[model samples]
Target: MAEESGGHATTLGVRVEAARREAAGVTSYVLTAPDGAELPRWSPGAHVDVHLPSGTVRQYSLCGDPADRRSYRIAVLEQPAGRGGSVEVHRELRPGAAVQIGLPRSNFELVPARRYVFVAGGIGITPVLPMIRQVAASGIEWELVYGARTHGHFAFLGELAAHGDRVRTVPQDTAGVIDLDKLARGAAGAAVFCCGPAPLMDALVDAMAAAGHAGQVHLERFGPVATPVRDAAADDASGPEFVVELTRSGITVPVPRDVSVLDAVRGAGVDIPSSCEMGICGTCETTVLEGEVDHRDDLYTEAERATCGAMLVCVSRACGRKLVLDA
Candidate 1:
């Protein structure tokens, strides 16, 4: 299969060209467009949304080189409790299989800094690995602190080890435990980018706060954190079905309590652009011209939510009588 160009149309059909096992329970798949042409270009931190057979969609980081236009490489870890996405990708997806994918997009970008410290935990290393490669190629001063339960469970261990002093593998069994305080204390001027489990991220946050380096810390959360449920009294008072107005199409669709605004809009055969239907990625964000949103996504910052102009359609719900969406 050939890769598709970025501009002809909004939807692009792709096919799995090849698949390889990278590590225990981890595999990488190369996908290309159906035209058998070179793939579209993407930046270092870009990722694509893969539509799985179970009708569940998930996001995977593009670990391959950005210059490689022939195909997009994505690594997936077979999560034990995953909602079928990763498991199906590892067990069912094969070369030549047809699938739907979103365009490359990213929110975790590498910014200019004097120095960089990358912390990767378990499979969260997917996105950071590309950044590490880019930084190393540029001869920049950077370090990677990779952590996993054991050496065998760690992905890309050999590749990371080749960097010698530039990489630190902190296997839980060998290193006892990762000490975020000691790791982040002295890195004052360096920018810290971390992607990992919630406990690891929380510890990093605390360590950075204690070291007065909160402003220098940037993080990408691969999964959603558990959020407390709203009080029963705080539920939508009317429990009314509302109308979602699509700005471009000038169409209004009915959104019921059982159906999300995304489903309602999509049912009308409108493509609003979405990936990681769990709301982990900000790909489905749309402008909100009217109505209050019951924000449920973790991707948006408090400030972004307060702007009152955009909302993530996957998990967020409407708080007002109706939502006017600019799809």
Candidate 2:
């Protein structure tokens, strides 16, 4: 898809050429340019922002092959308790429907590794599917532990069959939950990629640490992660207010405990593009010029956080009294 003339806010017009049921409560949509043209080149873990007819936007991982640019594919799991993104897609989006979408963006990039271990839960399998294909083509040894509520809920079993015994399916109804302890036992040297429900990711992270492979794992979250809530008494005792200096704009904004740096900076008449304001999208990442940041985002790796030069301004707060940002 060609980038339009809307400055950096360009959106591609795509038609839903095909929609198929992948599994129970899950459906895959194939999007292509209205004229049947190749779209943008994207990596394995990339996702596109889908703009619904109702004006509600949501991000869905590209599950199709990265080698094929003629179409962009995404799988949506009907989320009844969600804020209506999935409901709109499952109910109203159909073949021949036109929708606007952003270019592919990736926060969960598959880093080079000698070997890999992938874990997917439910619809979280979307992003991992592409990564497995890439890794297999590269001749790297890899394994996948895929789990769903039941065998009926599993998708992509036919594609995974080519991987042979490297893929393990654990349906909760029959096989019970996945055993992270056993899965992480000998996975120390391989890069581990996981995308799933928050609880599964949390358990895997903790399990990896217990198994002496903490730094070997990477994760992509489907929604906002749970951040620690600072107690009112503790925050007040430590002087909760902080100063945010927008270096490029040459403005000093006082960020009270109740206001986020993103809101405070924007209040000073500076525009910062933000999506998923809860800090999951990595859209509001800002360079840190000074001060300590209490990084609260799950987007950054340990090494990225240790360097401490960039932070997601949406949920990240100041650890010191002042923070200088290249905004």
Candidate 3:
């Protein structure tokens, strides 16, 4: 087994034990800690940061049973327009390849509720799948509404089908669009967990809200939306670089224009916990001890953004060229 790192450390070295093709363009990787040791135990909805070549690091959720401590399993869809991370993992990474992984983090966790409803679209099933499995294993009442562009694009159909009546697959080509109104009706006291394309999530949120089920909804975003061009006046070229003090480590890192505060801190080997690398997952959220953050993520609500004191590190720049983080 690989040497176990200290308790809940931010980063650890792991090795690829195996990789196999799962579908047309998806592959699953089995990662084991160094020396083939047991990996850190993680819960449902947890994800890890995968360091790919070209310095492109991406996050993928653990798709297998969290109780299985021997290794972690992650499935990757080779997006055509990807920044070469998934493709490189599929083509170049081989067994025994070493990679750095961040500790498991989760914002889309399952909360205790009377019942559960899971909605997944295409690759978004990566996180929702394990949650469904855990709910099923625990004998909790749950149902899955999975959608894909086509039947061929759907993963885990066999397992889902084996569940008989509990899971429903909606292929867009065959089933048209998912009827959120029907799905949300009579769903009171049931927590709804959804992960899918933004449009689908938006529809679900709107439909649930109209059906009076908004309070039971939870979502996770996988990427960032394109930001509009900032007004010229908002650009301050004369602003001086600010210092971000890490509260836990007592380290101060300079936030330069060329690099984000996240990059500066990570460059110093201080793991601030991030994923998506795109301001979406809210994984690298840290409290603001001082300074304003030009919040850039779409995940947090306006009120939550103001009250949480947390900021997404992927694309959010410091409002004053420097921001203090509770690292």
Candidate 4:
């Protein structure tokens, strides 16, 4: 199926069946159809865009079992300093409250491997939890290195304990930070999936590279890897406007210096599935039929970027005066 688009008109309405505090400042919401009908099926490492009443949308991982079609579960960590989405989720998402959500989307997909090594930090475990369950049930050799600020900050401890020594719980206050080199060494010759804070993500990539485990490392970043969004002043000083030709839509949109390719096309009534406009999520990725792109997203790998096959319209721009997108 294609990515969810066409704005709220295409959104699915769900009622919050239950809301439980999983950990310190973190809550998990179980959403189901009002009539208790079966919902869509999703795999591990999948997330949904939650549309709040305040018009704010946030992408959250589906941590619940994929086989359970009765409902979808998503966990949210309250961020006091964030851009208000989490705050609204914490305050307004109560049991029986109606909510809208986009269909499940996955970028951090689980590949078939002889063994899997999962690394997570704090709330990063949301996506990895279901993955762990799926692999564990298969009797495959898999392990998890999960860390948080403290033991009390860790969610699903009771569940993780079922895996015994296969799960390594490291509370920074007592265990110190996870050793990247040690982790890389242990995960060599195995498929490694990591999702966490920027520090851990950056260090693990380097460590994995040094240990000659480059192709086996799969990471899902919370935000941009390097390039932050340009400021208004920076945007003003950016290159001239560019034209984007959408082949499928058969429309030509003008992308102004201060505007993104996403805003430009959406302004022209071209709806695209997008959540994090900051270039973190892969929702706005568009095929590039023709164009020199200024790729700015963390979603694509180095090999993928070298091919110039796709571009994240939310933040990436054209390298020249024109671009042809599949849309």
Candidate 5:
């Protein structure tokens, strides 16, 4: 979704200027500088890591205007059954509360495109909301296929309505699930950006791959995905070492069996920003120049992995002796 230099993720202290309810169980918090100053700049598909008062950290996509440096807005959905981070945010992060936040990191950053197709489900719309605005303002051809539990469950329907016929609202209560095959067929030659529940994201990725359009797809995984428990000892004992050539940094580093590419790259002084090193967060996604990968990340489908256009450097490794990376 983007091209930016990756480095250490920094932390900042900010105050919640306002908190407005966006939808049922959804709250949008506007965070601003504590001393009437401007916040860091961020592009579309960016998100910040919020350290809650209860010591739980959660990442939320920036849904506000990127031009507005005065404040940064993020929407959170109360996931009572899933995790405690959202619950804590909905309860404690009210207006006037001071909170610690991470600088915006965007694995889902929006790049220039020919045509754009955005498929968002439920709370997944947060990252796509700003993308739509940016694309629409650029006079680029784009459309959004948004689905929710019900019509009222939508957070920014009012804002979406301004775009007229380009938005397709599919409420699952009355209409069935979005037809993945149809959506993929219609998105030919268009760059597809999808962020949604696991099922929808998984199915659409398969559909896109089956249609031979995997190269133009981008994704943002909002929540955690199931991953096999990583046994570091087992990996250290059996993992194979490989050489990585960082084209951008004009350097090469040896990735030992015990260490990951993320650590190797960072150790070599080329810092690729990462979060949730388990490969579920998609933050360590790096462009692949050559060599097949033993893809260990949950972010890519089986067919998408075959493309090998990118890999999550945190947990994924090389399938050959030498690999070239665009990082």
Candidate 6:
């Protein structure tokens, strides 16, 4: 998800113009300006941070046409066992209800490529929907492998049906899980974009790597990438504690093995606005004045890391014994 820039947060008041069931336990919402004005421009693969009336904030991908500025459409999957945001969206948000939304931002940008392959699972299809539309409109060669728990759980079938054979639906209940190996083999020279559950993404990553197409694969994740659990034995051998200097705050703190850089900064009474403390959200991003970063986040691209100027403080640590941050 995107971050609030400059630590200043602003929300636009938008009214729920329409709501309809797209699939089982999933609802599509169309939000528009109350005064019928044009909303902020957003490209494909963008998402808005929705601030629910119940005081919960959640990010939902904008799946509507990028050309449309009158309204933004997003789909929500009711997750009973997960956070309350989805629950409130499903049960409370309705037509005529007012909502606060942040500006649309995209982390998963679709770069120009010769061909594209999209793989989506469950609600993860939302981000890929608009991407497929863009690629198809450009007359570019593209295909989609969308999967869900059941046939009824798949959304946007009517919209995607016009593409015919270009789109493949795999209902896991009827068919088994999507064969990533087969897809990977077929996606030899294509740029593969995937968004789904962690396991599904992990499988795609492994498959793409095995097919020697890892560099062409791009993904969008709602949560942090899973890291291995470090036991005491692992921490003992992890290495020496690093020192982090907050340039703006003028404080130097020792980041111990047991704590993260984010926690260390907060412990020193310096507040850095953050959400999704796991490093998936770009909220806690800090400028690296000096020192290499042991990037543990999946947000930054290789080019961004090459600059060695920015790092996600939530999970990323210092590569050397000493580091400086432009807090």
Q: For all the candidates, what are their Cα RMSDs to the real structure?
A: 3.1, 3.0, 3.9, 3.7, 7.0, 3.3
Model 5 global lDDT (CA atoms, 0 to 1): 0.86
Q: How many clashes in each structure? A: 5, 1, 6, 0, 1, 0
**Candidate structures ordered by lDDT, highest first:** 2, 4, 6, 5, 1, 3
Residue 289 C-alpha lDDT in model 1: 87
Question: Which one wins on TM-score?
Answer: 4
lDDT of 4 by residue, 1-327 (tens): 123444433568899999999999899999998888888889999999998998878899999999999999999999999999999999999998998888888889999999999999999999999999999999999999998999889998888999999999899999999888998988867899998888888898999999988888888778877756567665444444889999999999999887999999999999876789988887788899997888788787778898859898998998788999997
Better of 4 and 6 by TM-score: 4
- Candidate 3 lDDT score relative to the true structure: 0.80
Q: Give the TM-score of candidate 5.
A: 0.74
Candidate order (TM-score)? 4, 1, 2, 6, 3, 5
What are the per-residue Cα lDDT tens digits for candidate 6 across 213-295?
89999998878777787566644444437999999999899999879998999999998755567777676789988887878
Question: Which pairs of residues have clashing backbones in candidate 5?
Answer: 1-109
The TM-score, computed over Cα atoms with residue i paired to residue i, of candidate 2 is 0.86
Candidate 6 Cα deviation (angstroms), residue 139: 1.0
lDDT of 2 at 256: 88
Model 5: lowest-lDDT 10 consecutive positions:
1-10
Q: Single out the weakest 10-residue window by summed lDDT for candidate 6.
A: 1-10
Compared with the true structure, model 3 gives a TM-score of 0.81
Candidate 4 has its poorest 10 consecutive residues by lDDT at: 1-10
Instruction: Write the residue-wise lDDT of candidate 2 on 143-232 in tens digits.
Output: 999999999999888889999999999999999999999888979799999999999999999999999999999898977767677688
Candidate 6: the clashing residue pairs are none
lDDT of all the models against the reference? 0.82, 0.89, 0.80, 0.88, 0.86, 0.87
Query: What lDDT score is found at residue 251 in candidate 6?
Result: 89
Error of 6 at 36 (Å): 2.3
TM-score to native of every candidate shown: 0.87, 0.86, 0.81, 0.88, 0.74, 0.86
